[model samples]
Target: MKPTGGSVGGFLAAVTPARRQRDAETLTALLQDVSGREPVLWGTIVGFGSCHYRYPTGTEGDMPLLAFAPRKTASTIYLESTAEYADDLARLGPHTTGVGCLYIKDLEQVDLEVLRDILTRSLAWSEAGGSEQAELTVTG
Candidate 1:
């Protein structure tokens, strides 16, 4: 997905050491387990796979889309929205939402089973080219 935010370098500049360390480790393990490929840095706040994207205005683009981030407030997992998973997400754990993303306060507060399920399904949805990045706002 095309990042509508800052450039990769700029984003990286704002990342704290703790956040960067956590994100690096989490993303490394997640990429191996999920996509079986190394995560490519997507602009800034995303570690993604080899997925592609296209906007409704016919602005076609491609990049790794399904990804995650370790924001100051929480760690976010970017998922492709799917109709079938609505109920599952509602019942999964404590979470908030943005335009198209889910916000988990922290991994420790949720069920790993449910989180894994969501991540797995989301990756599938993204691979199928059915999801988009949310216009989310971030705060430290």
Candidate 2:
């Protein structure tokens, strides 16, 4: 995905389901704090930093190094190499995963500290050029 130069405030303000909106705000702040990067809108996703990923099939694109979206069902947290986070995920509280996506239905149900650690590690991984890693695993 590409950054749309969209206003993060406008996007968050337009979020439906007041609860989701509130959670999005909290997440936005948390991500920004942890990432130390300004939030950018990649389509509907609020993302921080950027990484260029080339899949095995050579389908490549640029995406946020850390990002999330507030959806009707849950908040989707994007991270790289989720397979490497098994232990961390176990301590993350109620959540589900799909490849690189971490789905959190309720942020309050999880330990914010653990979430912060996970995001921190994930950011470090991306900064260390994880997208160019020889092997990319996302078995979650």
Tell me the deviation in Å of residue 102 in model 2: 0.5
Best by TM-score: 2
The number of the candidate with the highest lDDT is 2
Cα lDDT of model 1 by residue, 1-140, tens digit: 55445554455456666655455465557645876554556565566555445565556555554577767776666655534567777777787866557776655566766766777776666655463443221111
Please list the residue runs of candidate 1 whose C-alpha ends up more than 4 Å from where it truly belongs after superposition.
1-24, 82-84, 131-140
Question: What's model 1's TM-score?
Answer: 0.67
Candidate 1: pairs in clash: none
